[model samples]
Target: MAVQWVLVCHGLVTLLVVVSFLCGQWPIFQGTFIERIHFFLTSGAYDYFLRFVGAVFGSKCSNAVLSVEYYCCDRPNPILQIFYLGILSMTYYFIVKSSFAYIPGYYLSGIHRYTSLLAVAVGILLFLLTSFSDPGTINSANVSQYLSAYPYDNIIYAEKECSTCKIQKPARSKHCSICDRCVARFDHHCGWMNNCIGERNTRYFMAFLLWHFLLCLYGTVAIGLVLAGRLKELRVVYILTVYYGIENSFLGLAPHVAQWLLGSYNTLILIAVFLAIVGMLLAGFFGYHAKLCLTNTTTNETFKWQEYMSWQRKLNEAKASAAALRASISGMSSDRKPLLSKWRAFFQRSPLQDGQIVQNNVYDKGFVHNVVEVIYPLSSRPSFTRPKLKPT
Candidate 1:
């Protein structure tokens, strides 16, 4: 029972880690002790722990240890790749080694084997493409060119230079501290890919997400079927009779059910559960990216725009209050203004209502064009004269 409890706790912790990493934001724990704990887990505590170990082990040994730690945490590394491949390999190993081969033999007619192989192949291909592809890096040669492509909106983005890169910051571009370079139309730096998901490689990143989700889904369904076949062979009537008999005698059936599940299809069931959880998480991630593509915005821009709009609202409120005060001082009666004029005045004075303070999405060239831009980036487009800037 203690061992079972430990296994359950381990599984829950693993799920929590995976979900927290995938979600990217955790508003529920904001300003809480859990948030601090999460921060320490991700950053401070790990560094401190490594330093402590280094101090104990002597400077020379510490250097080697810290270098390995930095390689895993501070930059893109093969840890995620190894973990992903290891999980897949184990799942396949269990599938082949298990006595329940009905899924591969009768149900799928050996097609499942080929499909699984293809899924893994395609997933790896897309992963490599996303990891290695240039995510529209803004260098000295093309910095000016990329700058010309999107004019300053003057709301969220203004004419500025990256202090790190020593180059002009193009509209929607941000310097990634980890990558140590300015990324054009920068989204967020993805640690999984160990690359920035920006203007150039976002399409490949999206494709990777799609393919990975499919692979997980495939594994889940295949394993689920195999488990079901094993259970069917045990006979549902006997299982149900035992379940009800225990209930009538006031004994819990949970232990019985768990024992049967673990004993009959332990490895396959574990893999299926993990794949289901991962698939669901990947689905959410894919949906988020799809929304970003549709809205013609990056993850960085989305957060920035939200903050900018909040600031704009406060500014507009102050202006409106001052205007009202001046109008009252001038003895302008509110009743004297026509209803339409009053309404117009109210709306025009409120930046939020008028939408005047909202940042112009200069890159949004309609839905179809925006998606095409992601797939075939601006860096690859033929050189042409800079077009006139569109109005907000």
Candidate 2:
């Protein structure tokens, strides 16, 4: 009972962490406690703790002791990177160790084990690539070039200089306060990677996500197969067979079978449950990134777009109210029109309809083009030169 309680608590904590990570990415939670918790976790406390342990043990550590203030400020720190890598490695180790030993011999005969190993290998490779890859940093040398990449649409993007970088802000570029640098087509700073995910590294990040999703999915399925094999071997289903005046219902036997399965394959069942939950979460993340790729937008841009829409809505409402007031004071017959009619007029004349509120997304060429751009970044494509920006 104690062990069961411990496992339950562990699983709940894992679930909560995963949910909090997802919510942290959402713009709605920007000022919420979820964001604060996310900030705290991503901060460099782990790094400091490790250094302290190392110092106490008289270990020779090369890295300087990072200030707590700097850590809390969200600067690039590798503390969480080790934690992430350790968790992934531990998960892979358990899956390989447990699945090979406990699963029935017949189920492990084919290329199933080889396929799972291959997925893990590929996932690790992608993870390394994403962590090390450059995320299109904007330096003084390439600032002008980046600026000419996309024309300013004047709504979400405008011609201005970054106060910190003191360089002209590119159309899609953003200054990352965490990294203390400007990034081209900046998406968001991913603490898991211990790096930014911008134009150059976004593709690698997405591929990493895909590969990780596959790894989790493969692990879960393999464990589930092992559980099924154990069930078949035990014939727990047949043992619970009921033969009486009452019909033999599988429903009646299900609870007993489940209890037997849980007791028999406890460890495998726990691993499978954890992998399945994490797999579903990864799938959600993958789908979101896929949508962003299709729309030719970044996480940063998506939040900005949401804010712009909200402001536009408010402006439209204000305009409608003013128009109604004017019509009333003038004693115009149009004042008698339905509220729907007034809203329609507002919509027709609103800045949104007139292309003032929502500007043309200069970077969005087409679906195929956008996908290609992400996969083969402009920085790598030497033959492609950005067109000159037209005067606004």
Candidate 3:
């Protein structure tokens, strides 16, 4: 019972941390404890650590630490890329060391051994493709092509020039500070890949996400089958029924079976739990990016749209308030106006509700075209080459 409780607690803690780290900034979790934890994990902890180092080790040491942090985080360094590879390799090593012997036991076949290796290799290949691929870097030579390909919506995007690159910036392009280059259709800089996911390599990034999710799921299920094979081969049920005099019913035998598994295969159980958590996270991440791709939106564009909508809403509200105030002043009279019933007023819709601002994504072509564009970026097409500028 104590062992079961420990396992339960471990799982709960892992889930909490993972969810908090990944989704603490989400609207649903805003103003909650999860958001606080997310802030600490993402920014606050590092900030405090820097302050402590400054206090204990003086300014010189603090400056050195800050330099290291800048290079690792603010600059395009391979630290996270290396960490990703390390984690992947280490996880595979641990699984092989602890669970490989049971691959061909009872429920699983020997072919899984090779298949698992192939799956991992394919995942790594996808990672490499995303990491090394050109994310549609807009330079002086290709600037015209990119500019012609993506038109400015005049809402979030406008015709502009990159001050750093000294080239015409296309709509939806952003100058990546870390990479020190302008990327067309910029999504975000992915630390794990040490690369920007943009027009050229978004497909590879999506593939990498989807493949890893499936890989984690496969590892979890295969390990489960191996454990099941062990249980069946040993005939633990038969032993429990005959020698231990336990009932054959599921409810009667479940606790003992769980205890036995927990006692014998705790390590495997832990790995399974870890994989399951990671798999679910990857699934969600992939789904989010998939939606963005379908809508022809980038992560950067989402933030832009949020800010644009907010500003528009505030502007409309201000205008409405001014109009109402002018009308109220002009219609001022000696007689008192009748007050509205509390219930009626509470349920009434605001007159300005219809004026609410909504996101108007001008770049969102139909679903199929948007998906195709991600897969085959505009810059790569022959028609994009030597584009003749024309009146909009």
TM-score of each: 0.75, 0.77, 0.94
Model 1 segments beyond 4 Å from truth? 1-9, 21-24, 28-37, 47-79, 236-258, 314-359, 382-392
lDDT of 3 at 201: 98
For each candidate, what is the lDDT?
Answer: 0.76, 0.77, 0.92
Candidate No. with top lDDT: 3
lDDT of 1 at 205: 93
Best by TM-score: 3
Write one digit per residue (lDDT tens) for candidate 1, span 1-392: 56555656777887767665544246876786556656766777778877897778778777888788778777767787677668767776776676335745334456776677787888878988988889988888887788887778887899998898888899999998778889988999887778889988999999988888888888887776666565566664366667555552315655665667765556666677788888898898899899899778999999998898888778878887787689777757545744567667666644335536746777677989888888878787776235546799
Off by over 4 Å in 3: 1-7, 333-349, 386-392
Arrange candidates by lDDT, highest first: which order? 3, 2, 1
**Candidate 2 — which residues are off by over 4 angstroms?**
1-17, 24-73, 242-249, 332-359, 384-392
